[model samples]
Target: MQLNIFELTSIYLYITLAACAFYLAIMFFQKINRTRGSGVDLGPIFGLGFFVLFFGIVYVCWGYMHYFGYEYDFHPLPLYKTGILMTYFALIGVVFFSEKIIGKTKFAFTFFSIGCCVYGIFFTFTEFDLRLFTYITNPITVAFILISFLYFLKVKTTGEIRKQMFSAFLCYIGFLIFFLLDIEGIKALLPFPMEISSIISSIGVIITLVYLGTIFLRFETFTEFGWKDKLRELYIIAPNGTTLFHYSFIRDERNQDLDLISSGLTGVEGILGELIQSKKKLKIVDHQDIKIIFEYGEYTTIALITYENLRIYLPKLTSLRVKFEKLFQDVLKDWSGRIEVFRPANHLVNEFFG
Candidate 1:
C-alpha cells in the first residue's frame, strides 16, 4: 500500500518520538543508578519524556485522520497539548534549578497550570477557530520556549550543554513558527509544496530530540565547573580503607580524622548497598543537616562533605575524581600510602574544582 506524504511524515514522527521517549527513560534510569558526585535529580525529566510520547501518539492519530479525510474537532486539544507542554518544561526548569531560589519558584508551575485551565475552558465553550485560537496560544507557546531557552542561557556556564540546548530550542521555535503559519493559511507563501514544510518541521523535531537526548543524558563533556564555594571537604580513599588524600575547610582535628570517617563511610556503604541491592557508587548521608557525598574512582573512592546542595557540587566532584585518578595512577599502584605524595592534589582541588 502506498502511503501519502502525511502518513509517511506521521510514521517518521512516531519513530523519532518513540526513540526520544525510550532514550529519555534510559537516561533517567542510568542517572539514578550512577554513583556520581552531584545529586542532580532526573525525575522531572520523566514529564518531558511522557510529553514527547503523548505528542507522538497525537501526531499519529492526526495523520490517520487526514489520510482518511476524517475531520473531528477536539476543542480542548490545542490548549491541552500546549499547556501541558509548557507545564512539563516549567517542571524541567525546576530540576535544572535544583535547590536554587528559582528552582523553589512555584510561580511558573502555578502560572502554567492556570493558563492551561483557562485556555482549555475557553476553547471548550467557544467555537474552535484555528486562526483565532492560534493567535491566542501560539504566542504563549513561542514565548515559553524562548523564555526557557533564555533561562538556560543565563544559568548555563559550560558552553557544551548550553549550545546543545540552544540549538534544540532554535529548531523547536522554527517548527513552531512553521506550524502556526500553516494553521494561519500562509503555507502558500512558501513557494513550495506544503509537504516540504512538513518535512522541515519533522526535521526540526528530530534535531530537537537529538540535542535534548544528548544534553539530558550527560553525554556532553562539561568543562565549566561552577562549584566555587559549594564544596566543603573532599577525600580520596584507597580500596583497602586507606585515606590517600583529603581536603577540608575545617582545620580541626575532628575533621582531620579521615581514617575514622572513611571506615565509617565504608561500613555505611556496604549496608546501603546490601539494603538497596544495587552497586551504585554515589552515596549521600545526612548528618547534622550536612550532606556527605561519595564518588568512587578506579582504585580509590572520593568523599565530599559539604553543606551545599548535592546537585550543585556533584559534577565538580566527578571532575575531581577523574583528574585525581589520572594524575596519581602511578602512585596509587604501590603499597605506599604517603599523603605527602598527593600534595599536588591540593593544587587540583584549588584549580579545577576549587
Candidate 2:
C-alpha cells in the first residue's frame, strides 16, 4: 500500500470542500429560519447560494486535478471562466441586497465589484495574467476594505449590528491581506510550494463566510438596539407609571426631581409604599415583570420591559411636578424604608425647577 502526493492532495481537497459545504448548509438553514418574517430583502440569500455553488465547483475541480495528476494552473480554463463570472455576479448581488436591506453606505462597492468582474474576465482569457486582474482587484479590494473599516468604526457605537459590521470589516481586512500577498507574489517568496497560496486564500474566504453567517443570524440583534435608543430618547417626554414614581421617590427625594423612574412602576407603588412605611426591609423572594433579589442591605431589581411598552408608557408622565413627586416617594422607600415628608422649597423650585 502506497500513497502518492496527488492522492493525498485529492483527499485533503475533498475533506475541505465537504466541510465547507456542510457549514454553508447550516448557515443557509439558519438564515431561512431567522429571516422568515424579518422584512429583509431575500436577494443576499439567493446570491450567496449561487456563490456557494460556484465555490463547490472550484473545489471539485481541484479534487479532480489532484486525482488525475492534471497539470492544471491555479486558475485554469472553463472553471476559471465560470468561477470568475459567478464570483462577480454573486458579489454584485450581495452589494445590492446589503444596500437595500441595511442602509446604504456608499456606491463605491458597486463600482468595485464591477471592476473586479471585468478584470476577472480578462484573467480567465489571458491565463494567470497577474498584471491585469491582480492590479485592478488589489487596489479596489483594498479601497473597499478601508472604506468599510472606517464606516464600521464610525457607526459601531454599541449593539449587535455594530458587532456584525466589525466582523465584516475584519473579514475585509483578511481579504485584503491575502489579496496583497497574491498580488505582490509574496507566496512565491516563501520556501514552500505555491499551493500554500491557495490555502491562504481559502482562509480569507472562510473568514468572509463566517462574518456573513454571523450577520445573517444576528441581524435583529444589530438593528433592534438602534430602535431601542430612539425609543429611549422619546421616553423623556413620557410619564412614569404611579408604581414607578413611588419607587423613584422611595429611592431618593432628589431622584424625583431628576425624572429617573421606571415605566412599569404603577402596580408596585402601593406594595412598595406599605413596605417602606412599615420599614419591613422585605426582599422579593420571587416576582414577575420585575424581579427583586434582596439580601442584607443591598437590593437588586431586574425589570423586563418590552420596547413597545416602554415607548407607549413613558410619555404620559410628562409634567415635572408629577415626575418629582413620584421620584421623591420612590427614593424615600429605597433609602432604608424611611419615608420623607418635605415639599420642594420655594426658591429652589424657582431656580432648579423641573
Candidate 3:
C-alpha cells in the first residue's frame, strides 16, 4: 500500500539521523582499531560511541517497523527494547571515563544501569512507548552533560579549545531541550508537533555527539599515542632562574635538580636567538629518553618534560602557561624568593596535565 506524506517524512528523517550516527560511530571505532595508544583510557569514548551507534541502528529499525507493524498491523516492537537496553549499557563506559576526567565519583550512572535492566526487561513485553522515551533518556543525558561541563569549567584557562568546548556544550544542551519540549510549558516555545520534535531530538543528539567526537579525536590521538602517560613534570620558571612551581605527573620521590634545570632554560631564548638572529626560536630539547617542551610568556616560561613519543600537547601546555603567567604577573615583576604564592598554580597543572 502507498504511504501518506507524514509516513514518508518520518522514514526519511530517521534514515538521515541513523546515517549521521553511524558515521560518527565508525569514525570513533576506526580510531581505536587503527592502533593502540598509551594515553588516558578511551573506554568511555567507546561507550559513548556505542550509544550513538546503537541508537542509530534503533532509528533505522524504528523507521522500518513504524512503517510496517505500527502503521498497519498495530503490533508492539520488542526488538527496540533490546536496543534501548544496549544503549544504556554503553553509558557504563562513560561513567568510568567521566570519573577520571572530572575526578569525582558519580553513583547515579550506576543506578541507571540497574534501572535499565529492570525497566528494560519489564517493558520488553509491552509496546514501544514514545511518551516514555523522554523520561528515560533525559536523566542520563543530563548527567553526562553536567559532568563534562564541570570538567571544562574547572580549568582556569581559555583559547580555541575552550571556545570549541562551549559550542559542544550548547549543542548538547539543545539536545536535552529538544526532548524536553514535549512538556506543556516548553512545547509552547517551539510549537512543533511531538512527532517532529522527537525526530529533531534524535538529530540533535547525534549531531552534538559528532561535534564532541571531533574535538576528542584530535586531542586523544596524541594522548593515546603516549602523550598523557609519557609526561613526567611541569616546571614554571621565574625570570631570575628560579623554579616558581613544579608538578610531577607520576609519584617519584627521587631528588632532582629542578632549580638547575630552570637556570639552564633561562638563556634558551637568548642563545638560540643569537645563533639564528631570526624571529623563529627553538622550543623542544631532546636528550636520550627525555624531551623538554617549552612555552614562553610575558612573566615566565613553562617547561614540560616527558618521556619519548609525546609529539604534541602544545595547546594544553600553552593553556597552562597562559594561566600561570596571568596568575603570577605581579609576583614575577618583584622577583620574590617565596614559592608559597605559586602553590595555587598546582590546580592549573592538574587541570591540563593531570
Candidate 4:
C-alpha cells in the first residue's frame, strides 16, 4: 500500500526509534557485564535494559500499526499498554542511578516513582481514556521531572560531573516530553509535512546513547569518584592475619605479595601496640607513595590501599566493617579458617565505595 508523505516520514522516524531502542537495550546489558566490580550500581543499568527492551517492542508494534493499520483502523492495545507499563520500571532504573551520580535525593522523587508504578499497573488492566491520561500524567509526571531536575541542580559537584548530569537531564527531559505528546489528539496536531515531533523524538535516542557512553566512561576511568584518587586494593584480613578476601580496583592484575605484606602489617600493628603504644590499633600507616588505612572489626581488619590518604573515607570503611560483622556474625564466632566464607563482603565494598 502507498503511503502519504507525512506518514512515510513518520514511519521512517519510528523505525529509526525501534532500531535505537534495540541497540540501547543491548548497550545497557553489555554494560552490566562490563561494569562488574567497577562500583557502578547494576540496579539502574538492569532497569534501563528492561525499559529499552520493552520500549523497542512498543515501537515495533506501533510501526507495524502505522504501516498496515492505517486502512484497517488497527491499534495494538495490549502491546502499547505493556510498553507504557515499562515506563515505570525505566524511572526506577534512572532513579536508582540518580541518587549515586547526582547526589542525595529527595524522598518525593521516590514517592512519585511508586505512585507512577501504581498508575502503570492500573493503566495496563483498564482501557486508556485520554481524559484520564492527561489528568493522571499532568500533576505527577510534571512534578517528578521538576523535583528531580531541581534536586540535581542544587547539588554541588565538580564541573565534569555537572556537565554529564546536564546531558542526563537533557535525555530524560526529551524522552518525557516526547512520551507526553505521543497520544492521538496531540500527535495529530503536529505539522503534517515533516512530522517534526517524530524527528525530535528520534533526537532523544541520540541523547540517550551519548549519556550512556558518558556514564560508562566515567565508571571506566574511575573519575566519577571525586573523593578517591588512585584506589588500588581492598583486603579483609582475619585477626589471625590470614587474608580472608582481596579485591583490586583495577582489572586484570593482582598483587600476590599483598597477602604477605598485609600479614606483616598485622604483625607490626600488634608489635607497635605492645612497644611504646597504647592498645589502640594503628589505623593509618604511610609508605613511600601509598597510604594504608585500616579499620578494625571484632573479627577482621579492613585495609584499603591508595595513593592518597583516605582517612576521609573512614566512615565508609567503618560502615563496611559494621555491616560485614552483622552479616557474618555467626560465621565469625564459629570462624573456620577458610577465607571463602566471606566472599559476600565484595558486594558491600561495591555498595559503599561505588
lDDT of 1 by residue, 19-108 (tens): 664566566545545624454433344444444444455444434443443123323454434533443343343333322322445556
For all predicted structures, in order, the TM-scores are 0.55, 0.53, 0.63, 0.54
Clashing pairs in 1: 35-282, 37-314, 38-314
| Per-model CA lDDT versus the true structure | 0.57, 0.45, 0.65, 0.66
Model 2 stretches with alpha carbons more than 4 Å out: 1-7, 18-22, 38-58, 61-76, 97-102, 105-108, 111-124, 128-131, 159-168, 175-186, 199-240, 243-354
Q: Write one digit per residue (lDDT tens) for candidate 3, span 250-292.
A: 8864787979878887676568779888886568877767878
RMSD of each: 7.8, 10.7, 6.9, 14.9
Greater lDDT among 1 and 3 belongs to: 3
- Model 4 scores worst on lDDT over the 10 consecutive residues at 216-225
Model 1 residue 248 CA deviation (Å) reads 5.5
Show model 1 residue runs off by greater than 4 Å.
1-42, 68-102, 107-110, 121-131, 156-186, 218-230, 235-303, 306-350
Residue 51 lDDT (model 1): 43
Candidates by lDDT, descending order: 4, 3, 1, 2
